[model samples]
Target: MTTDTAAQDAAMPTQPATPQSRAIKEGKFGKVIRTIVMSVVAIAFLYPILALLLAPTRTEHSMSLGGIAVGSLSNVQFAWAQIVGFDNGMFLQWFSNTLIMVVGGAVLAIILSIPSGYAMARLRFSGRNALIFATLLLMVMPNTVLTIPLFLEVSAVHLLNSFWPLILIFGFYPFGVYLSFIHFKTALPMELVEAGRMDGLSESGIFFRIAVPLARQAVALVGFFGFVAGWTNFFLPYVLLPQTQSSTLAVGLLQMISSSQLINPEEGLNVQLYMPELALAAVVTMLPVMAIFIAAQRYLQRGAMVGAVKG
Candidate 1:
């Protein structure tokens, strides 16, 4: 009887490992691997920004030797003094130019894009689809491709080497229009618009009273993106503004760094901007955009999720 029972037990096959059991065993290992890879990627991205932040607090010689160690605040003050003293205070001029262009362009873009998008989404006009298509085409087109043509157009209008040209070009934001159009079409309730119309509100009245109020997220998104674009615009400003003092920070900073002893050590220019000063300038350039992003972070998040759902 014992021999027969042993033979039967041997004949029976062991239960195969189910998918749930396998997943339970492998999930912990997968999580560990993912965590390690993400950590490595995060470090890789942060290292450069860390180095940039630290560079302004240390002298060029110390930076070359000390890697990314924190240094004294006095070094930062010295760097700022060097930046302020350069080119009869051209850094301040560049900063003011960047500020005006970015703010003006972003505000103009918001004003134009909101109404245009509302018209496209709600109004029954002729050639509306064609207009939307053109906007999409322009949105996909690279800004670099339009640089030469824009320069020529600006020159034709006698607006070259001026702030108006940069502000106008930055204000022509097709992507913002598209984003607004999508938000209105997908996220906004048509019933509210109909109710406004039924209540004797004109198209403009309905737009201002109903559409704009509800589309705050979209507006914020457009404004933020427009500000960033205008703030970081280097090529257009570089091409249009030939004078150094007239240049925005994006163009001026690069020119300053490249012409100084930091980049061209052999050049006989007496300007002695080193890595620390240049790094400080770069940090200063980035601060406004960073502050804007941090302030509008919640709005941006809500805006991004606006048209994600159907209804």
Candidate 2:
């Protein structure tokens, strides 16, 4: 072809016949397929949550009927009243206990992690490598494995049957330690510390001023995980604080379910009381986790993979 014709052809954009490219260009079949697949996956994950949310609003009769229809607001109000009224406002007490424990654990974990991780990452200390290795092992090991040992320790210390054990145990999250360590090791710039040092800042001053702000993403990540772990923890609190009145939501829910059946004059035994109220408790317990996850989404997405791969 002529030189001008070839130049024009080279300057023009080219389109490929790949399915994704064609889908974007034409906006049809491939988009439809992807949309359908995502919709199916979304429903698969969400339907269970939807059912749980709906349960508190439902009655034995409506739940047994097997339809998608929502129940009246009165049923929701009834379930709420029942939960709050159970054992004379025990639910509120349990909720307050849980909040205190969760906040204490999360804050302590973050506070300890920031310094410990920074030391492990920046300072030359004995057993640093061993500590990192231990943190990794603890992070991977199922929490149940530590329960027996932790129980023994707590019992020996006379901290059992109290909130301190729950708060302290949950606060000592090795995963948070490891996350902060990895973040500092991989993402932290040593030049900043040196720069601070040159400017007459002590190690503590450098860490507090330079390192902390740069590590906010890691802090959010660790704090979110710590909070969730503490919130959902069941076996530890159940075993540690055996008192019914001192139960957190997870243990409280378990207690409610275990004692679900009730005897009546008209009926020999029934589980009707367990259904709606238990469902309501479960939903209420999970709300904080959902809220935190949503609020921390930006930091989570940004920092989740920060230290996963080498820089």
Q: Estimate each model's TM-score.
A: 0.87, 0.83
**lDDT for residue 87 in candidate 1, whole number 0-100:** 83
For residues 99-130, what per-residue lDDT tens digits would candidate 1 score against the true structure? 99889999999999999998998898999999
Stretches off by above 4 angstroms in model 2 are 1-35, 262-272, 302-311
Where is the poorest 10-residue window by lDDT in model 1?
A: 302-311
Cα lDDT of model 2 by residue, 70-108, tens digit: 888899988888777667777788899999999999999
Q: Please, what is the whole-model Cα lDDT of each candidate in the order they appear?
A: 0.86, 0.80
Choose the strongest candidate by TM-score. 1
Q: Note the residue pairs that clash in candidate 2.
A: none
**Candidate 1: count of backbone clashes, pairs at least 3 residues apart or interchain:** 0
TM-score of model 1 vs. true structure: 0.87
Question: For this target, which candidate reaches the highest lDDT against the unseen true structure?
Answer: 1
